[model samples]
Target: MKIAVAGKGGTGKTLVAGGLAYLLARAGYTTLAIDADSAPNLGFLLGLSSRDEGAIVPVSKNEALIAAKTGTAYPGVYSLNFTVDDVVLKYAVPTPAGVHLLVMGTVASMGAGCTCPANSVIRALLRHLIVDRDEAVVLDMEAGVEHLGRGTAEGVDMMLVISDANRQSLAIAGRIARLAQDAGIPHIALIGNRIVDAGQEQVLRGFAKDRELVVTGMIPFDPAVVRAGIDGNSIATLEGSAALCAIGGILSRIDQEIKERLNGRVDTEKHS
Candidate 1:
């Protein structure tokens, strides 16, 4: 299964993405977590120390690697037909959470149709990971779906648009859900995070219902999650955390949804 976690900034989408990746890995799926956020803090949630996370370079910023993959003999010209299947094997960082991470950084030219070399490499690599690879992929995307071009977005089985009780966050999540739908993602669902009570849950559900988006799961306000972030501890090691438990439910829902969708497609093809 391939899922992309996206929401407005500070809505805790990265935490959800990382937590899903860890759980999928624990469940015996070879999982790969892609940090496509511009700020890129998913490393912290995946058990990387501050030093290690800081030392790692994002794929878009990796000048040498980008050149090797797309550079040409002529100045200002680059090739687009090079293979990117080896990028994961060569650059994916193995984390303590047992999930490999590929920090793609921000695809600045994404969706703008710019054929720049770096964008080419990044886009191709993302498509390769999502479409070619068999492992479960949890992508922590930027605030919007612009990073996901049509081809890259189609490979994702689901897009989890996370939101909090805040109105602004919910609004952004609605927009993201619509964008993911337009991008041809099979399943687009909303995940409510930091929910404080039934009222907050109701609010999230109401918002999603109004927008015709499904609410896959709701994560209650968990102080332990806040403390873990403050203390620089990985959620993977934080047992008995309510937020993690909630994310586990979300993961199960995502898995089931993808399976059902795939089965439905197979049935349709058989009938056709």
Candidate 2:
């Protein structure tokens, strides 16, 4: 299963992505959590550290350089420069948690027509890593759903849209949900975060009602999550805590939904 956790910046999308990876791994799926954001953070969340030992391979594409390499050949004929392995970072990380991470390569500012080449390579590598490798890959993505272009991993099993209790956050969340729809993404669910006040519930319900989106689950405001992120604490190690309990339920729903979707697809194929 390929699941993406995304939302506006600072909405705890990475936290949910990291926690979901941990939970999925614990369930024996051999999960791979990817930090596809240019400025990556899933590493810290998953409790992995590089002693600044390995080079941060810039995954960005220098379209000009690549064009030069192609020597006036058609852009379509220009082969990609980096391999999937070249961009994937194997942090000399030691964790009993049993998961792996890949950082999306990054580069500085560029021209208007230039989208991050690293983004292209990373997206290709992500497709290879998730669909080709068939590993349970979770992408901790940046805010905009624009990252997911057409004819890519548009077939992902789940497109999780994370949001907070604020209106601005919900606005972005709804926008992404529409993006997912435009691509005809198979599954889209919302995870509302920093939840408090019963009124926030109404806002979410209204968004779901107006947009017809799925509220997979809600994560209440929890300081444990804050401490966990700030301290690089392993969420899998949290025991007998409210935050952990909430996470457990969230993970359970993910599992249940994945199972149901897989089963539904299988039955459909059989009938056809």
Candidate 3:
């Protein structure tokens, strides 16, 4: 299953992504967790030490690799069809929590109408991961869906728009849903984070209903999560965490959705 988690800044989307990836890995799936955010904190949430996090060179900033794959031609020339199949094995950092992480930093702009080498490599690598890889892939994306083009979006099985019970957050979630739909993402659902009460849940459900989106899950506001963040500890290490429990349910729903899709396909084949 290929999933993308996105939300407005400070909505705990990274936490959702990390938790889902951890759960999937623990369930015996080989998971690749990609940090596609500009300010990458999935490493921290995934329990990577500060030193290990610092050691990770984001693909977008790796000049030599980018040049090697995209060529050194300036002004008007570069290879758009470069191979990035080995990038995961070559660059992914395996965490003790059992997920392989690949950080794709933000691409630098080279004026207008020029596709930078870093972007080219990142796009190719993402395509390979989403379309070719058999493992469960989770992308912790930026606030917007800018990194996901139509081709890449189509390959994703689901996009979970995480949001809090706030107007601005819900508004952004609506925008993200529309953008993901425009990019051909088939399933888009809302995951409510930091929901404190029934009122908060109602707010999220109402917003999702208004936007014609599904509310797949709701994660309550857990003090353990805040404490972990403050202590620079991994939330996954908190055994029996309420937030984690909620996320596990969400993952189960996602798994069931995948199975339903496969069963639907099989039924269609049998009928045909």
Candidate 4:
């Protein structure tokens, strides 16, 4: 299963993304967590040491790798097609949370029609991970709606748009949901994060209802999550935390959705 977690910054999307990866890995799935954010901290959330995380290089910023993959004999041109399957084995770093991490720094856009070599490499690598790989892939996408274009998230099983009760976050979540839907993402889930009470939940649900969207899940504000951020500890280490418990419910929802989809497909086939 491939899942992409996106939201306005500071909505705890990384925590959800990292938590899902850790849980999936612990559940015996070969999980790969991609930090596609410009300012990445998924490695820290997955319990990668500061030194180790610091030593790692993001794929888009790797000059040698990009040059090798996309470089051509021409001075002003680069190759547009290359196999990126080997990149995972070569660059994915193993974290203590049992998930492999790959940092894909922000892809630069020179113009509306421009396609830089680095951008090509990232697009191909993302497609490989989402459409080609068998492992459970969790992507922590960058803030706003830049990361997802027409086909950027096409093969992803689900796009979890995280939001708080606040209007700014919810607005961004709505925009993201629309973009994901336009991108042909099969499942787009709006998750309310950092919810404190019934009022907050109501606001989130009311907003979704007004917008004709569904609230797939609600994550309460857990103090343990706050402490983890303050203490610089990984959410994987917080056993029995309320936030993690809620995330567990989200996992169940995802599994159920997938199962139902498969069953529906089989039913359709039988009828046909």
lDDT score for residue 23 of model 1: 91
Clashing pairs in 1: none
Q: TM-score of each candidate?
A: 0.97, 0.80, 0.95, 0.96
lDDT of each: 0.88, 0.68, 0.89, 0.87
The candidates, ranked best first by TM-score, are 1, 4, 3, 2
The candidate maximizing lDDT is 3
Residues forming the 10-long window of minimal summed lDDT in candidate 1? 106-115
lDDT of 3 at 195: 92
Q: Model 2 over residues 88-107: C-alpha lDDT tens digits?
A: 34432334567777665453
lDDT, candidate 1, 1-272, per-residue tens = 89999999998998899889999999999999999988998888889999999989999999999999888899988888899988889899999999999999877657678888888888788888888899999999987887677888888888999999998998788888877887778778899999998999999999988888888999988899888888988967666689889899888887787788789999999999
User: What lDDT would candidate 1 get against the real structure?
Assistant: 0.88
Clash count (model 4, backbone only): 0
- lDDT minimum window of 10 residues, candidate 4: 143-152
Model 4 alpha-carbon drift over 4 Å, by segment: 109-111
lDDT of 3 by residue, 171-191 (tens): 898998998888789999999
**Is 3 or 4 the stronger prediction by lDDT?**
3
RMSD of each: 1.2, 4.4, 2.0, 1.5
lDDT of 4 by residue, 1-272 (tens): 98999999999999999989999998899999999988999999999889999999999889999999999999998998799999999999999999999999987642244588888888788888888789999999975445554565677888899999988998888888887776677678888899999999999989888877767789999989989999999867677998888888899899889889889999999999
lDDT of 1 at 166: 95
Q: Residue pairs in steric clash, candidate 2?
A: 59-105, 59-118, 60-118, 61-117, 61-118
